[model samples]
Target: MSEILFITREPFAIQGNSRPALHIMPDAVYALVVTDPSLDFEENRAEPGYGTLLYKAPASSDSSDEETTGQTTLHRFAFTRKDLRSTCTEAPVVLKLLEIAKKLKAHVLSDYGALYFRDENGLVNVTEDAQAKSYIMGDKGTRYALTPDGALADPASLPAYLAENDFSFLPETQAEPRAEQPQHSEKPEKPQANSHAPAAPDYCKGMGTLKCSLFSRAYQKNVQLSINAYYAWCLSFLSGINCGYQDFPEQMLRYPIYPSTSNEDIAFLNAYCTRNPDDPFISACLALRTMRLERQ
Candidate 1:
């Protein structure tokens, strides 16, 4: 499959760097400023969107960027501090973002955030170095809202500009910074695998088996072996079996237990248990819903 690398940074900084991560594909490289997280999932996507590749959130729910008034759906990728730098002129949208970042604060970038592109032949190649460019430029659209120094005339205009461009680069809104992924040291730390004192059976652990089966069945048809065994516990749920899915690691329990997500198992809990969160069972149900079952 054709894939592109995303060299991204949360702090559009001059020194900190990140490795090139694979992205599925590129959007309109010509559109000056297109969407990131892609406009397709600005709301959040369960599956790839059809046609234009954008997906809509459920009618009943609000968008990831829902406004206080409940009228506007905030765009997810608009004007993020986490900037993307690409040497491709085809990436006009990115050019616009860099210009805006400079205007916001003249923090000349330091470490190169490079994305290596691989064509159909599967030959990985370093296509460009962002440092090669002299000055990052923005599209003409930015001129309309600029002050004498070229920053947006009003803070509101930034949001408006973001809306017009479909939050392609990133939104200017402030969000609670997400926790950083824990980093491991150069030397691997060895651990005794099965050192736990054994877990007691509860609805959450028991129902994890159920999800293992259901999601596994759904996953099998989809053909993703990585998450297959988790379904075994879920399968236990299907047959009305009651046991802690954690007990047997291979088929019964496993290494690298995944954190559970309440959103995923919402339906099964509503059907089999309670809608009220006050119920401990409901809380446990939440734990098993989207738990990865096994580590990546």
Candidate 2:
């Protein structure tokens, strides 16, 4: 089994003063505690010094010995003045604690009691929250705060927004029935070059109705439209991509179409509305799509 080093806060003797500490549990029997010198009962807070490591004895069923309740000093570790004020993950003392965990081949448990790992960029949170994972993975384009109707919304409104939207267009799990094959093997006929061909399907047929001004106003306030205009546009945009009408970047397409809106999309719409308030929302979406394609 892998070991774990926990970073937590311990209260000082002085009121309202707390310092970061490290707790390591080698086994179920005993635990180790490392505290800053400023938290020492004999030391003055104004003049902090080296940190101390203590060994906590295991609990006993019988309260026969008084020494079992006390901790024994194991060793003293050197630290700078900046380490005294360390509290966050990037702090000096916290970095030292990470080094210690590295030496022991253990994982660093955050103050929230969740496991975390550090990289070249910074600390990465390992949790079940999708938004938190996206933020840590440098995918800020998936963190938009707009509702389906192009209205601003808070995080608390997500559940209600999701409840109101209809997602019946998504694929079903049950396999569809297959058509029976023809008994006869007939050769296909080729069409004449001069013959008129059928027109291509119109993927973006119903879009370009909502005015940019109305969208901007709705985005400024928490207004809901009678219809889900933004969702309709998203469906149209996705259809355009599927039908090869829109040439969006393959890399950017990895991000989700719904629930994850790009701030760049909102910004482009806002700027286009500032320039052409009477223009349709679909015009801004097309322009943004063209700009993204040009960037590639």
Candidate 3:
């Protein structure tokens, strides 16, 4: 599993190149970051930002703790120290960090406090304090708090009322299942061999490009798409295929195309985008159809 160890220190605590002392665990496999006053910086800064992401050297009997701490600097952001706080969470760096976290399946942690994990929706902040209100970022960038009863407490009332509720009543959160495959008749009619390919549905016409990036991100993380997007895409792809099958039952049957409810199509698109980020999202969907045909 991927992990990241985040260490935060008091602002300006490191004087004259002195670094924080890190206790390296022998089995630790995580990306390391050390920052002043921690990564959970307060909003706003008067100057530019700066920081470093370190890759720990493999643990060895011959290596001292200091030698194993930061063997290679994977990334560094440099600016005026005063601005480092603001820059650390800038869009570009945040995206990069999220991408890294997703790849590593990293659970974001602060040395001082809080734990975070990335899911299909986005980052979820789960605190150790049961009474503390946990927050999650929505796909549309809205912030919602999880109440003790597991309801999404009103965002407007979050600050004022969330803390007042005792969290001992909080129930264990269960993982939602991925997309459910649509039920189909056990025996499907075969489409005619000479039938033309199905036309794209109206709803799907311009959706691929619009939804591609979001789908790509979730695909890379091997998670399901957001609820609305998943259902919409399913409706489009499956409806079109069903229409074609009804129109030409015989031909379509020879090359059966089973709709993937487990995100096989997303994986295909992810690979497609990795090869060419600029490729139209619809092109990958079309290619997936062809692949299914060949496999059949």
- Candidate 2 local distance difference test against the native: 0.36
- Give the TM-scores of the predictions, in the order they appear: 0.20, 0.26, 0.26
Higher-ranked by lDDT: 2 or 3? 2
**Candidate 1: lDDT of 39?**
33
Candidate 2 wrongly placed segments (more than 4 Å): 1-207, 224-228, 245-255, 258-260
Candidate 2, 101-173: lDDT as tens digits: 4433334454344545556776543443322322110011123243323232365743443332211111121
**Candidate number that wins on lDDT, 1 or 3:** 3
lDDT of 3 by residue, 153-235 (tens): 47465333333221111111212254653466477456422112233445655556543455666656666545336436644
Error of 1 at 280 (Å): 19
User: Residue by residue across 75-180, what tens digits does model 1's lDDT show?
Assistant: 2232212333322222232333343343332222323434333347644334345433222122222333233232443656555444333322321232325575
Error of 3 at 265 (Å): 3.1
Q: After superposition, how far is residue 215 of candidate 1 from its true place, in Å?
A: 0.9
| Per-candidate local distance difference test | 0.30, 0.36, 0.35
